[model samples]
Target: MRPEAEPAMKPVFAKIGKPVAAKFRPDPFQLASLEAIRDADCLVMAPTGSGKTWIAEEAIRSVFQKGGRCWYASPLKALTNAKWVEFGNHFDPANVGIVTGDTKENTDAPIIVGTTEILRNQLYDAMHSGENLNCDLVILDEAHFLGDLDRGVVWEEIMIYLP
Candidate 1:
């Protein structure tokens, strides 16, 4: 006699759902952070993948509308570059510039994106030259990296030096 055929096994995972076509809405926390930053200094602490970047974008938009400059510092070169590209797309390529140890372009753009260490060095230079950093808003991404033993000091220096 032939062996009985085994029953088909069920799939382990659920089928992927169709992508939702929903309009984007800002979260209350993001709006609050934007307002706080507009009024005074703000330290936003949220889990990764949350809308922390949205607050930064709105704040930068406000500054740009007033013809002011902005500086965005990230802990890693890759992150800085990614933001440089992302901001370029959002704010226009002509308005975005990047300055790092390896790359420097469009230094006079209204928006500058660079690594945290470069920002610290610029602060040092500005202090030595008795001049202020020509930026209205300064956003520090991956700020928790400020607690790192090796590079935390640079972040601390930036915090202390930036007005």
Candidate 2:
């Protein structure tokens, strides 16, 4: 039998010249979304790797500037944990807190991060106890997950019950 054909070798590119440092600037779309969020509810849709998270960070900054509280919800616990650490870095560890089924810390902090399911449960508790959610801004990351058949209802309930 003839020997099997050798696989083609892929080309490797050499490192280019020194990388240039570019000044940071916000995209117009990000600016527009931030403005809209200040006046009313806004839904931002963008591809992955886009600066969507920056919009959330700016919004949170505005609320904190006014001495207001914020709640950031993500569809996954891992995302929540990551954001908890990130926002902690941005706003200082003393101001940021996180609550997941596996972990809970500084529950009374001004900036709270947790899974959307936890937020929905908090809403249920608030309704039953007749207490208002003391939050000025609610940032739901990966909001498209609201269409998930299994957990979509929780997100829907949060939208309906959140003030």
TM-score of each: 0.88, 0.89
| TM-score for predicted model 1 compared with the true structure | 0.88
- Per-residue accuracy of model 1 over 54-114 as CA lDDT, tens digit each: 8888899999999999999998889889999999999999999999889999989999999
**lDDT for each residue of candidate 2 in 3-96, tens digit (9 for 90 to 100):** 6434542222223546799998999999999999999999999999899999999999999989999999998888999999999999999999
The prediction achieving the highest TM-score against the true structure is 2
Please report, in order, the local distance difference test score of every candidate based on alpha carbons.
0.91, 0.91
What clash count does candidate 1 reach? 0
Task: In model 1, state the lDDT of residue 84.
Answer: 94
Worst 10 residues of 2 by lDDT: 5-14
